[model samples]
Target: MNRNLTSQQKNAVLLSMAQLIAAEKAVIIKANKIDVESYRGEDIAMYDRLKVDEEKIEGMILSLQQLIADVDPVGKDLFHFTHENGLKITNKSAPFGTVLIIYESRPDVTVEAAGIAFKSGNKILLKGGKESLNSNLKIVNLWHKALIENNISTNWVEYLNYNRAKIQVFLENPTQKVDLIVPRGGEKLIAFVKQHATCPVIVSGRGNNFIYVDIEANLNLALKVILNAKTAKISACNAVDKVIINSNLIAKETFIKKLINKLLKFNVEILGDVELSAFENVSSFDSDEIWFKEFLDYKIVIGTVNSSEEAIAKINKYGGGHSAVIITKNDKTANTFMESVDSAAVYQNASTRFTDGGEFGLGGELAISTDKLHHRGPMGLQHLVTNKWYIYGDGQIR
Candidate 1:
């Protein structure tokens, strides 16, 4: 809990961390395999998260390298001006000083957050989930080794090694040593942090994305987008959880039939209205509950909308404010949907699955935030830093 590192020492620690990850790629993969084997008999959700093979390790390495290549987010002047009274004001980026990141399941977040904090010049304390404890420990050990190699204080990247009680103590530690608390986990974890922690909390809430297929949308394009969005990976936060189609298009039956065939082939269950009941593959469900649900699976809830306004209303009412997409050929319709829908990331002619930090070209994201305040959408290195003002004057006191 000590903040003793100078800015120069912090940067050096991060540089060495990047070098270590690149050099010891095989070590990371080996550690991940230990976790994967331990969770072999667990549920699918836990197993998928615990399993990290060579591909995932490669992705982590590439993301870390990209972060290393990007310009340092700290120390840039955002604004500068001088008043007539000779008061000089300059707003510039500065580290949050110390950050505490509490996340779950995803071992990759360890590397992602560490790299960003290193580049932005902040000391970080990480508390990863127990499910992936083995993987997290391995990664954190390498980071500490890197710090020693570069002659930097290992305190810059401290990992909380205790259990739940210790985590709670760290969050409510009131020492105020931790400036920001970022929780990248489920709703319960985020809610507990938000309600209990005195430190500023960045809530990266769960994602419930939606996609609307307008009447003017080409049938072929809609099918491709829907398939890619839902079937790509149902477990991800950005995957399509709900789909709304224009009533007019449903009457045509051509698009609905094609969509149903593809979805069934992938074992995706469809819950739709009476209008869609004619499709043999779909099952009818009450419209109310389905609209508000975020099915983090291959199951999708379908609703028929009267117009673009209705589609927007449904999305606003049901969405988790993470990501929403509209498929349409009309520019005016697409623009209207984009402006009216209130979400962190809105898309046109694309799948909601593309709402990732790497896809947006920020190397990778710490998390996809549903919170509108402070950090929104895909968070990168810049989001980890805050701004401070520096004032200079020649003995001119107001």
Candidate 2:
């Protein structure tokens, strides 16, 4: 922990990492292709996450570059004060010492999350899903090369190629110092980590996000926002999985028809609760189980609420607490909805897709946290640290 590198040294490593990625683009793509080819389409969400292409590679490079450009997150003095007893106390941000990120698919996380941890002065332990082993190994190798080029230790970013049994054992009794564990996949994954981890676990919980359309909502705006939120990236945690429309909405039937037709354009499978199940082209939800599902697919559920209070209650009951949106022109209604919804990110007249860290202007994120301990939103470069207090005294003691 005492081996701290200067900002210039860290930036050099990041620059080298970017250059290495650009130079080895073809190799990385080849590895990703092997994983993509192995896909049998058994799990659509996993398949989507595992596949990495040109754009994802560019995104990885950009994440590294962004971290290099941002201010050094460590060593910032948070508070400094002196006691009347001639004692000085200083509080400053410090690295978590080590951060373990366990994720499924998403090979880009190997670069982006590791980059964030590295820039924040935390030694990152990356345990990626086995499906992306080929790609992850290659990327971690590049990171090590960059660190070596900058005369830094490769321990800053270590990759753990462990099977499920090994991972469970490590979590239960780690030989290493695991300061924090972030599980960034499905509910089962998050639950597993939480069950076994001896250290604090930051849950990157699933996004069963919801959007409520009030009576005063602009139909056009609602359509646009919902379409983008659902179709833009069906696999994203920020994608809208369910919608609650006001029963008193003006031309409610017409709006429902429009929503159904638009979703049909993207082949989105529509399911509705009892309130909307009678409508044409909408199927009834299979039990209340649908309410708790994080549909990271081309599927969505539509329900109805008679009042804003009802909408808020329904969301708080079933939503994942990741993000919630309200499409209402009335400022008062929007404020009430935003304030009442218990979510990490609340939106008014906007898409839930903006819940992403990069989209939220954080450059990149380790994950979108639903936990309210250290953080509740995107775990970005700045959110990755804890703090330390330094007390100084010459002849004073407490």
Q: Pick the candidate with the highest TM-score.
A: 2
Off by over 4 Å in 2: none
Worst 10 residues of 1 by lDDT: 1-10
lDDT for every model?
0.81, 0.92
TM-score of each: 0.93, 0.98
Off by over 4 Å in 1: 1-15, 40-43, 174-176
Residue pairs whose backbone atoms clash in candidate 1: none
Q: Could you tally the backbone clashes for each prediction?
A: 0, 0
TM-score of predicted structure 1: 0.93
Give a tens-digit lDDT track for model 2, residues 91-114.
999999999999999999999999
* Model 2 quality (TM-score): 0.98
Model 2, 324: alpha-carbon shift in Å? 0.2
